[model samples]
Target: MIRMIVKDLRINPLRTGLTALSMFIGIVALIAGVLVGTLGRDYLEAVNARLSGRTPTYSAIIDVTSVAGMQTTMTLQERLAHFEPGSASAQYHLNDLAIWASSGDGGLEIRHVAVTVTDAERTRVMPAPIIEGAWLTAADKPATLETVVNENARQYVHDGTITLARTGNPQQVPARVNGVIVDGADEPVIYVNAAALQRYWPQAWTPDGLTILVHPDAGVDDRHAKTALDDLLADVGAGSVSSWNRSDNADEYEQVIDFLQLGVIVTAMLLLAVSAIGMINIGLAGIEQRSHELLIRRALGATRASIAAQVIGSSVLLSLIIALAAVLISASLVWMVPWMMPADSPLEPPAYPYTAAMIAAGASVATSLIGSLAPAIKAIRLQPALALR
Candidate 1:
C-alpha cells in the first residue's frame, strides 16, 4: 500500500509539488508568527527591566512633614540600610530625595542639575546600564560626595572633580563624577548616595519618595511582602502611603503582545485552511482522472479500506515532509537572528520557540487528513465494472 501510494504521488510530480508548496507556506507563516511574538515580548521585557526595574517592584511616596511620618521614614530608612539578602521582607528598599544642585567649571558658568539622593541599594533596586565608569558602592568615601550622572548630564560633567553646591548657595563642595548611566531622563540628573548627602549636606538628606523591590528569588510572594510593608508602616504611624506595582504596567504590555499573537496565528490558520481547501479540490479532480486505475486495483483483490488508506497516507506523508522542511528553515532563521542584529542593539534575540514548531507540524498533519477524507471516500466508491466500460 505504501509503495502504491508513493508510485501514485510520483506519477503526478507537479500536482504533488504544488500542494506541498501551499502547505509549506502556511506552516512557515505559523512559525514566523510565533517567533515574532516571542522576540517582541522578550525585547519589551528587557527594556522594561532597564527602565522600571524587574517584576514585583513597588514604588511609594512618604510624606515627611509630620512627626509620625518622619519617625516612620527613619525606621524604614534603617531597615533599608541593614537589609539582608534573601530576607522575608523586601529585597532592596530605596529612599530618594530630589534636590536642585549646581555643577560645572566654576568660572561664572554654572549648570543647574537635578540630584537624587538615594541609598546605594538604588543600583540594585532599579539598575540602569552604565555607559561609563561604575555605580555607587557601600565602600565609597563619605567625606567627599561621589555622584553618577545620567547621559544628559555627562555633556557638562566629566569623569573628574566638579564643584557641586545647592542652587543659590555659595558654599560649594567638590564632587567626583565616578560614573555615567542611562536613566532615560531628558534633563540632567545626578545620583548621589544618601549617606554621603547626610554627611556633607545634612539639609538635603530628607527623602520624599521611596522604592521597594522584591527579588523574584527571595522566596516571598508579592502579597505577603506588601502586607508586611503595610504592617510596618502602620506600626510606625507613617502618613498616607501611595504605592504602585510595576507588574501592572508590564501586564498591559503583555496583553497587547498576546492580542497581536492571536491575530497573527488566526491569519496563519486561515491561510492553512485555504491550502487545505485547494488540496481537497485537487484531490477530488485526481480521483476522477484515476478512476480506471482505482478500478484495476479493486479487480486485483485490493480491499476498499486499503485503497482509502493509500489515498490518505499519500497526503499525510506529503504534509509531514513539508512540515519538517518548514520547521528546519524557521529554526535556522531563529539561530541566525542574533548574528544578523547589530552588536549595539539593546534587545537580545531569544532562543527558538519549540512549541511553535510542534504546533505547526501537528496542524499540517491534521489539515492533510481532513483534506484527504473526501477524495479517499471517492476513490473507494469507484466501481470496477463502470470504469472498464
Candidate 2:
C-alpha cells in the first residue's frame, strides 16, 4: 500500500508538491503568529515587573526640612522604629536630606540628595531595569560612608574615591562610590547607611525621608492606606506626602496584546481556509484522473475500505511533511530574535512556542483530512462494473 501511494504521488510530482507547498504556507503563518503573540505579551509583563517592583508597595516621600514638618517627621520616625520587616505594613526605609560637593576631573559637582540611614538593611526603593553595578547591601554597613550614586554622578568617581566637602567644614571627605542606580530620574540620589553617615556628621544624621512597603497580598487597599497615612501625618502637622503607585499600564498592554493575538488568529484561519480549498481541488482532480486505474484494482478484489484508506493515507502523508517544514522554519525565526535585538534592549528573546507549534501541526493534519474527505468518499462509492466501460 505504501509503495503504491509513493508511486502515485511520484507519478504526478508537480501536483503533489504544489498541494504540500500550499499547506506549508498556511501552517507556517499560524505558527509565526502564535510565537509573536506570546513574545509580545512576555515583553510587556517583564517591563511591568521591572517598573513596579512586582509587588504591592508604596513609597511615600515627605518633606521635613521646615520647622513645622520636623515634629511630624520625628513622630513618623518613632512609629516606624517599632515596625518590622515582612509585617503587613513595613517601613522599607528612612532617610534624611544630605547635600555635599564632590571634586572630580570635571570641577566640583554639587549633589542634592536624600540619604537612607537605618540599622536595618534598606534596599533600593525604585530599582532601575538595568543596573550597571552592585547595589548597597547590609554587608556594606561596616564600610564607613560608602555611597551608591545615580547614573549621572558616576563620572565624578576616579579610582573609586570621590572627594566630598561638607557645608560647614573646610576639610574634604573622600567616600567610596560603591555603585550606580540608573532609574532615569533626574534627581542626584544617594543611599548611605546610618552608621556610615554618623561616622562623618554625627549630629546632622536624622530621618527626614521615609518609604513604606506593603505586601502584595496584604489585603490593604490603596485608598484606605492613603487616608490612614494622611490622618497620621496631619495629626502631627507633617507636610503633604507624595506617593508612587503602581501604574495600570501593564493591564492596558495585556488588553492590546489580546486584541493582536485575536487578529493574528483570524488572519491565520483565513490563510488555512484558502490552502484547504486548494488541496481539496487537487485531491478531487487526482482522484478523477485515476478513476479507471482504481476501478481495475476494485475488479482485482480491492475492498472499499482499502481504497478509502489509501486516499486518506496519501493526504496525511502530504500534511505530515508540510507540518514538519513549517515547525522548523518557525523555530529558526524565533531563535534569531535575540541575535537581532540591540545589546542594551530590555527584552530577552522568548523561548520557542512549543504549545502553539503543536496546535498548528494538528490544524494542518485536520485540514488535509477534511479537504480529502469528499474525494475519498466519492472514490469509495464508485462501482467497478460501470467504470470498466
lDDT of 1 by residue, 1-389 (tens): 77887887897888898789878988888888777777777666666765666554665444433422333444655565454432222222223333323435444444555766555566555557676787765533343567888877766564375556554555666677778787656788787655555566665444444445543336666666566555655665654346645442577577877887788778877888988898898889888878888899898888999999999999999999899999898889889888887543446666887888899899999999999999999999888777567
Best by lDDT: 1
lDDT of 2 by residue, 55-158 (tens): 44565565444312334434554444343332122232333244455446755654545444442223332334436555543432355667676666665566
Runs off by more than 4 Å, candidate 2: 55-131, 139-207, 213-249, 288-303, 328-343, 381-389
Residue pairs in steric clash, candidate 1? none
The alpha-carbon lDDT assigned to residue 354 of candidate 2 equals 90
> Model 1: what TM-score?
0.72
The models' CA-based lDDT, in order, is 0.68, 0.64
Q: Where in model 1 is the C-alpha error above 4 Å?
A: 43-55, 63-108, 112-114, 119-135, 138-154, 157-164, 170-189, 195-223, 230-255, 288-292, 341-348, 386-389
